[model samples]
Target: MAGASSRGGGDVAAAALRRCTATAIHSGADPAWSSRLTRPRERDGMVVVYGDARRRLERRATDGAPAVLRRSTAEEEEETRKKVTGGNGEKGEREWRVNVPVVGGHAGITIVPLFSQAVPKANLADEDIKAPTKRTQDGGTKVVQAKAGKGSATLSMAYAGALFADACLKDLNGVPDVVECSFVQSSITELPFFASKVKLGKNGVEEVLELGPMSDFEKQGLESLILELKSSIEKGIKFGNQ
Candidate 1:
């Protein structure tokens, strides 16, 4: 009789939890924040943050220069980050340790790093993450900007496609701690799930850590980000499915 009663109580607790979760979702609240006060685990999110490489964005944010000039600056910076030697040397090897995330929906200014909430934490600078974010976010406009009577940067499109293939290849080779930040459906947000950091591997993401604790700066950033991220997500879903 006691065992049966305990089981019934457990079911009631579970049901209440589900209802509460649904309510939070319906009301547009990030449930993770309320679920705890301070989390100690260092988690990774759905975006990769590298170091220094994002210097291109620093210029864009400050540029009084024309949009085309800003884009030109960004392109130069991106080119600088790469190391090419494939056809040039057969005995030579080139590897890039730069971090990248497959963030959902164009990888724009909404580059929400799921770093702390992701499996493995990658050390990165704000510029590193932010620059790529701007590129991803504004890539559509970039295409428009570059196509001045001429065709376009079909080359850029192909490069991204091939980069994705390479990332997949490396992860398949049992590369330890292969990671990419991508938009993933998760229990982390008010919505069903949102984009964040995810660790890539031979079998895809093995585990997703919680978003852990945030510094005051991060907390404030997150507060500012919620509305924007939410709006973007809604826009995508509406446009894509409808």
Candidate 2:
């Protein structure tokens, strides 16, 4: 189910998951199979998925960067330069659409964006980073506020879901180097399920990438988010058991 953040949508998605689990049980299949992809909107799954994809597709042109970097189109290059330089050789308000690597859990303060690792290298001041970081964490709330109780960010969420689904499909089809961030059964952290970049392959998550060199701010954000993320994961497990 796409855009399952709303209460009604979330209920439907949960029911669907339960049904899938039930079917797996009946068929003597492992319900905890890694090949299964559950897009839970309660956790902002698509946001990180699409964000990672954008990082790979659009923001990969830095010299001496990782393999994720690529030669971007001229337009993309211009946009990145403009956004980072503010078109006047002075750092300004960083554009929200830039390729930002979001980590941690998918809710509130747990939604940590490593702006220090943002592509095109937006050298934003510490004061300037605070606003966008908060905005990233409160993205859903901002949408609700902007809509005045009318609706949530359904359209954008749907688009993100589509992008994630496509990436999964491409990986399943034997595409190489198909890496995207996902909340999966992980050993990268103490948490059983944590969001991080993972290499997709025919067998699903082939490898979970490490959280490469983080700035002090990102490290602190990760540290602060762990407790809340652990609490949320525990709660979800408790609810699922019930």
Candidate 3:
């Protein structure tokens, strides 16, 4: 078992898996299996969880960015209320958080954040939508640059891996409706694999949810990302076969 980022991490893992006989458990930003694991005889339960998507949404909410949604504890809510109302018991605007479902492969343009489908509606202007979308896509690059190329987003990647593992455990223990967005072998789109909301259960992925409705902006983002994602998947498969 190992954790890695999406950029070339999955491709390397795929090649390594090809040389081994044991079942491998990979937790990272991309679905490392590619076409190999999608075969009927080689099928194994796997999921790609991108934690940066959630982190970016959290940053936006805390920064008072518009149309963001949040999940907060009662104590945190009370503290926010006091700050917003100036502790004068006056009603003021409340803070919110965003839940953006990230799809496609985990890479530069391959990462797609469906802000229009965000919870509580990210009702952002076109420019606003573009900003976060690009940020989500280039998040790993930004982290690398910030550290002067010393390391990647190892901490955040670890957190996302742990979170997904816990979800898988709960589902295996009979937890119902344990839903999470994951990159898996999907028929929801023309691509062989895609990232979308999925219901996890004892047998692994019980249901793959549809992308639902998409705003024009979101639709365009999805369309533009497919070619690059397909190329990356194919590249991984080629490496595995070599």
Candidate 4:
């Protein structure tokens, strides 16, 4: 369930949690909100899974593994250097038609999708590849605009939550090869907690997978996102502990 407000939501969720004995799975937009909500539960010795929806969508796209990498084409490289364009020099279509490996936190600029490292090797031009990356980053805003601001991303958030929950159930049932990305206490990066592809098991996180091969574009994204991601993570840790 979504947390109402950072403080109120945390208090409510924490109180409600004391009444149950279930593994906690948090699905919300704000990492700080989720951090505030899940921290007390974790402190109480409950298993907690915390990842906002956008990052979970990325996990679903990648099929829960760090995809095999391939070298980017020259055209792709050129497009990465500038704004993507079509052959006629007009705006292109919006489509993320490949399994792009996404990492980092679920927020603007921090949501890093590795389009160049997409599996099955998308033959799309670099300009086209950027389409999905931008869309993925702005997906929530797009929904809000389409709704004319009457509502937020209610349905999509529900779907993302169900998807993660399903993966958890499969792993708990001993279903072989159940992998999903989640934000947990991770050593994958320098951050105390990070979102990355993780293998799920009966005991919870079986293994946190390594980020596989990436292109120069993806490498740059990784470096750029880390700073912001670190700040956001530190903010959450501080707020949660408070």
Pairs with backbone N, CA or C atoms under 3 Å apart (clashes), candidate 4: none
Clashes of each: 24, 1, 4, 0
Residue 142 C-alpha lDDT in model 1: 56
lDDT of 1 by residue, 190-213 (tens): 655454455666655555545566
Q: lDDT at 92 for candidate 4?
A: 37
lDDT of each: 0.37, 0.52, 0.53, 0.50
Off by over 4 Å in 3: 1-24, 27-97
Query: Order the candidates by TM-score, highest first — what do you get?
Result: 4, 3, 2, 1
Query: Candidate 4: TM-score?
Result: 0.61
TM-scores of the candidates are: 0.40, 0.61, 0.61, 0.61
If both were scored by lDDT, which would come out higher, candidate 1 or candidate 4? Answer: 4
lDDT of 2 by residue, 1-242 (tens): 12112123434543443322111100011212211323344233433433343333222222222332121111011111112223112444345455655677766667767667676677665666676667666665566567665555444444444455566667756789986666677888888987777787766678999878776777778888888899867765654454
- Model 2: residues >4 Å from true position, as ranges? 1-97
Question: How far out, in Å, is residue 73 in model 2?
Answer: 28
How far is 96's C-alpha from truth in model 2 (Å)? 8.9
What RMSD, rounded to one decimal, does every model reach?
21.3, 14.1, 15.4, 12.3
